[model samples]
Target: MDVVRSKDGTRIAYERRGSGPVVILVGGGLDDGSENEPLAAELARHFTTYNYARRGRGESGDTAPYALQREIEDIDALIGEAGRSSRLFGASSGGALALEAAASGLAVDSVAVYEVPYMADDAMVRHWAEYVDQLTVLLADGRHADAVELFMRLAGSSEEDVSGARSSSFWPGLEVLAPTLAYDAACLGDGQPPVGRLARITQPVLVATGGGPDPHLEGLRPSFFDEAADTIAAALPNAERRTIDGETHVADPQSFAAVLEHFFTSSGDFRQVSL
Candidate 1:
């Protein structure tokens, strides 16, 4: 892994694979760059892939008091290190970060994202406060396990699914990263999509979601999944929507990469999509 210094002088760690135009993969909550290696490898043939650890996870250094702009600068630092304005693909909460980066006017070539967890109404937002409150208390008290469960609920995980995950040995890693959950909450901007800001994104963008008919999810309507994706796509000035039938939150990299390749390879323009 290589390191780049953020504007704040924090060391951001990243690994580059293959060769061609640079493409950076941003991982979602509780994940570092390692989780996106599958997708990075799939994209490597067509583009050089940079899989980097987000701040507070893996090898990246986290400065005191995480702020939204600091995270954006992390992406900017990677873009500078990549030696060009690169295409970025962020999954889940990381998608929210990528959108903010593009909207921040980082010299991005294109942006692609998967299921950014946008609320279609204020109902989710109302609960977001309580969720964050409880999560903050849990983390402050060092109850990492309970904090993880609260976060799972906020992410719409059912009790059964939460129990199952807790039983798994990998659950502790999530517990370790519990504090960073608040960072994702902050990036989401009060628990809804930032319509006005997203509208300012001038680069060609693709917003994608799982098109599963019955994927056995809990806490929200199944239809809401596609609705959230559509909401984000509608907000972006130059964005297209794509659905991968039968794919859910944990998407198959090979299948997801095809959609990404198609979107990124096409000669899409802000004027073409926005107008």
Candidate 2:
């Protein structure tokens, strides 16, 4: 893994592959470079892929008093390391971070975000914070299973689906990453203010939703994925929105790769196309 030092001197880790224009894949939650290796490999055929571990994971350094800006700096350092002017693909919370970085003027050439859970409204944000707190307490009490349950519940997953995931091997790993849930929540804010700050992001942007997946909670208002995509598209000068039909919050790589290929290879003036 190649290493770059963030502004705070934290050593960030990333894997560079493929050989055309550079594209960085930033995963959400506890994901490191390895989790996205397959997607990176697929994209490698067309672009130089830089798959990186966010701070506090893999080869990266972790300092106390974590601030959201530090995360942005981490991406900034990686973009610089990749020689600037690279395309970016960020999923979940990573999507939110990527959008913020682009808006902050980090020189992203093109960008695509899949289901960034921005609480584009106030009620959603409050409920999200409550869920974060509930999950935190569950984790503290050694209730990893319950923590996952709470998370899926907050995310609007059905009871049966949550129960099924509990038996899956991925559940344990998610538990380990549960502590960082608050970080994602914090970045999203209380859903009141629109992600207006991101309006300045000029990079050709694609805001996407997984049409296959339902809202995490039952009776939850409008879909978070739609909310996020619309919020971003409305803000950016050059932006489009797409929904990956038959794909949910947890999507197959092939479907995602197809959507990505279209966005990255688009010609003309950044037309909004739904795949």
Q: What is the C-alpha lDDT of each candidate?
A: 0.85, 0.76
Per residue, candidate 1 scores C-alpha lDDT tens digits across 77-140 of 9999889989999998899999999999998999999888777777877888788889889888
List, in order, the clash count of every candidate structure. 0, 7
Models, CA RMSD each: 2.6, 2.8
Cα lDDT for residue 82, model 1?
84
lDDT of 2: 0.76
* Candidate that would win on lDDT: 1
Query: Which portions of model 2 miss their true places by more than 4 Å?
Result: 135-148, 214-222
Q: How many clashing residue pairs are found in candidate 1?
A: 0
Off by over 4 Å in 1: 213-216, 268-275
Task: Assess the local accuracy of residue 122 in candidate 2 as a C-alpha lDDT between 0 and 100.
Answer: 67
The TM-scores, one per candidate, come to 0.94, 0.86
